[model samples]
Target: MSGFARSVVVGGSGAVGGMFAELLREAGSRTLVVDLVPPRERRDAFLCGDVTAPGPELAAALRDADLVLLAVHEEVALEAVAPVTRLLRRGALLADTLSVRTAMAAELAARAPGVQHVGLNPMFAPAAGMTGRPVAAVVTRDGPGVAALLRLVENGGGRPVRLSAEEHDRTVAATQALTHAAILSFGLALARLGVDAGTLKETAPPPHQVLLALLARVLGGSPEVYGDIQRSNPRAASARRALAEALGSFAEAAGDGPDPAEGLDGVFEELRRFMGPELTASQDHCQELFRTEHRTDHEGEKDR
Candidate 1:
């Protein structure tokens, strides 16, 4: 009585896609999944048909759906939207899991006015983030349908960052595209060198762990997916170039002595401006985490 009885997710087999199905099921929606590959357990039926098909199978699956999550990847997202448009019922909420929001939102607005279009970006890896993380939402309307989405995130233990389409894509370009490119570049080089990562880990300094943690994900996702994200966003290339320049400065400083944090003066200055002297709190926290660990390492060696 409290929740919607019917919901369906298309292409809900992959990580983020499967998450959509999982959340909806936990929300008490009797969900159906349409994908070539079967989704994890939320689905009532794992129908192996192209939802892009205009045939009765796609239509029938969508006809009774109160909500539909378009969870396909970006490359063929437009094509996925086209057929689903014909099948969604009047006032059905079409929550799309997508990165670029401009075209997707525009197409939905033009075709399905007031039909509850929401763009979603799950800001964590599926392996570890289901219990608690941030999920971004770009809403076309602020009503019951949007509330359903808000509830979906809350129930899934995710914080929601609501934004407009323009803001959504812009943030994704900087946060995801640019950062992913940076880590992936380093990770790919490391892979090519073919060093024993486990052996290297034993000698890796504190900063290397940070790089490993960041690159761990960038290397796991489809390389083609990363390539598309970096190329699709116009601002991504410039950002990556700027990051490259900054890294080059760090390299030069390491060999010759610009004293490590030389260029970081402005950064620290701005950060101190915001956090006052409390910015040094991280200095203590880092010392506790890394410095203490090293102290323990020395003790271990002495014991040996």
Candidate 2:
């Protein structure tokens, strides 16, 4: 396909779906948003209905849609397979924006055979826009539709990374699962130590301050979304276990335990090797980030 002429977003009420709808519209597609709840805005492009429960409106939307984005929650997305597949016209592309890919990919392959499908996971919030953001694209069945979808991401300033369903889930287990676990654990530790936000701001070192800010950002988001990320990925348990083991080692090193400093040094060296050429660049980036954060904080104080 040259480009999608008409696109329908099945769960366009939610943040991710809404973002996908916006991006498709910006990419020059005539977008229609279908959701159970009334659209918050952009009424011109929205239809209120449950996708799983078929209706004429949804049927009409899917009949002419060149691209259909399943942008609902993971569980809902899975349930929508039968209904969506039934409604999707031949040659129309079906793509999903689920955070976890393995299960959805398998379901789509098994239930919607011969359908050109793609799995998408946007690594950042929609409000942040796609500019410089990473997007994981798992092409279950490659075709012109898949190419157009990838091109759409590129047009909207997203970096599209192609990965298998398994690869995508495994990577997210480390990147999303482990990272969120560590940040949430940090927040919990602060609470256990009776550290208040004001006290943290007043006394924490720069690194600690940076962590506190990250924890705050994580907590500010939907708890259900984070919970789903932790629960849905099969490898998440291993990542959590690894985090616990590392924390235990750190505690042992700090306590009256045998000297594990050599072991720690070895681990540090391994990480440095993994980072390799990126280490210096990463450090520079962090320094700049810190400077910008400090300036923003000082400006906020002046406003106060």
Candidate 3:
């Protein structure tokens, strides 16, 4: 069959969905945007009808579609998908753009038996488009949809990195979910202290500057988006527990005990671990990303 044979994208008015529609069109896919909100006419075709509280209109729009991508919330994803399952082409690609992947992937596979399904975890901002970005396609063992999905990636200038559904969510739990939580916590701490971040720039170190830049990106990003990333991932709770345990260990190592007057034992313990024989800490890898002796001729361009 031709790629995405009559693929219909649900929810194309919002940021992620809109970006998906734009990129898919650029990639030569004949995509039709479908949603509940009165569909604005797309440069391509669109169908506006509600699927949750199903009606004939929504069911009719889904008929003969070879691919259906749900670019909405986890709570609404499966429900929006269920009503149109039987109407979808026998082997249509059923995928979602939800951050909480494992459960959704499993639930989707169970509901629409024999359907080609996967979970997409995009690692960059929707505004980033697809150029030079890494899109993790968490593939299901049963699906024959990977090829067409990879084609979609290539069309949008992305490198499609294949990962199992489990592996994808595990890595994201740490890399994205936890990382966003820490950055957001840092912002909250700054706000509590009445610290205007701009005041720190003159005396800021490079690491802190990078952090400030990251906070700006996160702050502008979806609150509910990161909320699910941090809260919904199962691994996060265990990770938080481990961090607290490590902190307690540090207190024991220091002479401080539970009292404030004593010195920190945690610092010494970490130093010892880093200097140990089994796994030596290497600065080379660290240096390449954040610090190195380098010179570049490029300077900030002035506004025209």
TM-score of each: 0.78, 0.90, 0.77
Ranking by TM-score: 2, 1, 3
List candidate 1 stretches off by more than 4 Å: 40-43, 187-200, 248-264, 270-304
Go through the candidates in order and give each one's C-alpha lDDT: 0.74, 0.85, 0.69
lDDT (tens digit, per residue) of candidate 2 on 22-97: 7888778899998888668774388888777768978888888999898988888898888888888899999999
Residue pairs that clash (backbone atoms under 3 angstroms), model 2: none
Candidate ranking under lDDT, highest first, comes to 2, 1, 3
lDDT of 1 by residue, 1-304 (tens): 2156788888888887787777777677887888887765644667787766756776887888888788887656667666776777777777888777887777766776657777888877777775668888899756677787788688778888898888887788779877887788888778899888897679777667658877885667787877888887666777788778877765665555456656556555666897777767865665565645566342222211
List pairs with backbone clashes in candidate 1: none
Tell me the lDDT of candidate 1: 0.74
Off by more than 4 A, model 2: 254-256, 261-263, 295-304
For residues 113-181, could you state the per-residue lDDT of candidate 3 as single tens digits?
566777776788777677888888876644656577777777778777778777877777778866776
> Which candidate number would show the highest lDDT if scored against the true structure?
2
Candidate 3 has an lDDT of 0.69
